[model samples]
Target: MKDRIIDCLAYEGKVSIKCMSSTEIVEEARKIHGLSPTATAALGRLLTITSIMGYELKEKDGNLTNQIKGDGPIGILTAVADSNGNVKGYVGNNTVDIPLKENGKLDVGTAVGKKGMLYIVKDLGIGKPYVGMTPIVSGEIAEDFTNYFATSEQTPTVIALGVLVDKDGVRTAGGYKLSLMPDATEDIISTIEQQISKIEPISKMLDENKTLEEIAKLVTGDENIQVLETINPEFKCNCSREKCEKGLIAVGKTELEAMINEEEKIEIVCNFCNSKHIFTKEDLQNLVDKI
Candidate 1:
């Protein structure tokens, strides 16, 4: 199935929510990074959450980057998303593994570590983009995001994120975010909390092939939901040879001359995608002349 994100308004506009399914995007990460089940879950949740946040700023042509730095084997996981529903991410330690929790689920908490900081940077193509951060609440992304919403963004939110991976690849990966607007009533907040308390793991819902509408109904009940938009999401890298060349040129003529003297060709590999770019001495000379 194609990956997509859906936006909805609930409780007669008292609350707004976004849900995204990113199985294909997450699968790409799995294949590229060779992630274990726990690592896949960690990276997938970041991608899904970042995608939804990206959609929230669609009008501004902004991009959102979600980063988690922790004291666990994974080290750090970073996901970047654009308004167009494109996402790409990587974890510092893709092969890290830990024992399952007492409930027999992936020990995401332990694998991610209990101590860390979640940093969010938004680039809105304006004077200065905003940045907010909060300490990790549980190392389970949902709770950490919820904490970030409350502390960093000053919005009360409920976030549910999950991913299930196996030996083959990511089987299911997605998340949901429900946020209460400033004008939301106490009754509406209470009702939403009640619903959230009974919510199931998002990965399980996706694994069952639940639609975005169905997931919304599960949280907001059958009554007050207005589906706003649905957008397909994917793993997309914006890196290109031209961009790399621009970066190389920015390194100045001295650096290029040194590189040219030391090696016949300078090979540059993109960290986001594994594509390599090779520049010969002639290429370096051209770049230097252009400067």
Candidate 2:
């Protein structure tokens, strides 16, 4: 199936669940970043969840950024998403390779290390952005996000993120985020908890061709669910050479002059899309004149 994010309400609207199949998005990222298997798993999981969270933004101009800085071989991973759930991300070490777990699973926790923080920044294009932070619990994206919601946002949440990678590329990737409304009773929460414990990984379910609606029902143990919205998610970068020029101009006239005098050409590469922008010395001079 195509990459899609579905928002649904279960348990008669007392429980909220967002499900997404992000295989295409993750595969594109793998090709763009030349990611190793473990790196694909780590960053892919981050990108998947970030897209779902970004879809929660109310304003068209709003966005969300998720940053994971850990003490592992994979130094850092960052993903950004627009209000429409288009996401782009880059890893600190795309070539990072480590041994898998004894169970033959990607050791994302070890690859991401548990000694840092998970930063969630929400910019609503308003007064000031809100930033929430929580300690990394397992360096597994889902567990870290679960802690973030419980402690930083004071919301009870369950998150599942998975990315299956092989020699070809990302085989499957997806996730789900479920939260309880204030009015959700103890019985409802208990039922959900039980259901979640028995469900398969999100990626596995997606790989098995389970639709988001079916996954929602499986996870929430509610046969009847209300679909709120369905959106297509994509791996898109908004970076451009014009944006690069603006960044270069921000370095001041003196810096521009210095660049013009010392360098024959300046090449700016975007971390998100790996797009390169080249500025000749004459281009620098022109920018200085504009200043």
Candidate 3:
């Protein structure tokens, strides 16, 4: 199925919820990064939520970035997303394989490490970007973001992220972000809490072919929810040779001359997409002249 992100309001528009199915996006990351099962689960969960949050950006040129730095084997995980919810990400270590929990689930918390920080940076193409950060409550991506929203953003929110990796690749991957409006009633909040406790996991629901709209209803216990918008999220990288050339220009003329003298050709690889850009001696000389 195609990746989708649906925005809705439940409880008579007192609560806002966003649901996303990100199987294809996660699978694409797996193939691009050659991630192990544990690594896939870690990065997949982050990418899922990143796409949803990216869709929330208002400006056409706005973008969001998520950074997870932990003391685990995976080191640092980074995901960048645009206003349309198209995202690209990379893991510091893609071959990390750890033992599963007794419940037979991927030990993402252990793989991601508990002692770390979650950073959220937003550039809305305006005066200054907004940066919020919080310590990792649990290296399980969802809980950490929940804490971030509560502590840093000062919003009462609930987040669920899951990724199921089979022998082939990501079998299922998805997430949801739900927030209570200021005018939300106590009774409605209680009902939604109960509903959230009873529903199946986001991954299981997506694997069962449950649509994002259905999942929104299931989580909010509001059959009469209002669908605000539907968006198609994608795993895309904006890296290009021109961007790489700009990066090389910033390295200073002296450094460029040294690189040109040492090697006949230089290569720059994008961390997010692993795309390579080669610069020959002539190319280096031209850039040096420009500087």
The C-alpha stretches of model 2 lying farther than 4 A from their native spots are none
The residue-by-residue lDDT of candidate 3 on 1-291, one tens digit each, is: 889998999988899999999999999999999999999999999999999899999689999999999888998999999999999999999999999999999999998999999999999999899998899988999999999999988899999999999998999999999999999999999998899999999999988988888999999999999998998889999999888889999999999999999998998888988888999999999999999
TM-score, prediction 3: 0.98
Worst 10 residues of 2 by lDDT: 164-173
Worst 10 residues of 3 by lDDT: 267-276
Give the alpha carbon lDDT tens digit for every residue of 62-181 in model 1: 898899998888889999888887889888888988988888788888888899899999998776878899999889888999999998789988898888877688888889998889
CA lDDT, candidate 3, residue 131: 92
**What are the models' TM-scores?**
0.95, 0.98, 0.98
Ten residues in a row with the worst lDDT in model 1? Answer: 269-278
| Per-residue lDDT of 198 in model 1 | 86
Q: Tally clashing residue pairs in candidate 2.
A: 0
lDDT of each: 0.86, 0.93, 0.94
Alpha-carbon RMSD to native, per candidate: 1.4, 1.0, 0.9
* Decoy 1 TM-score against native: 0.95
Pairs of residues clashing in candidate 2: none
Tens digits of per-residue lDDT, candidate 2, 214-269, equal 99999999999999999998999999878888998899999899888889899988
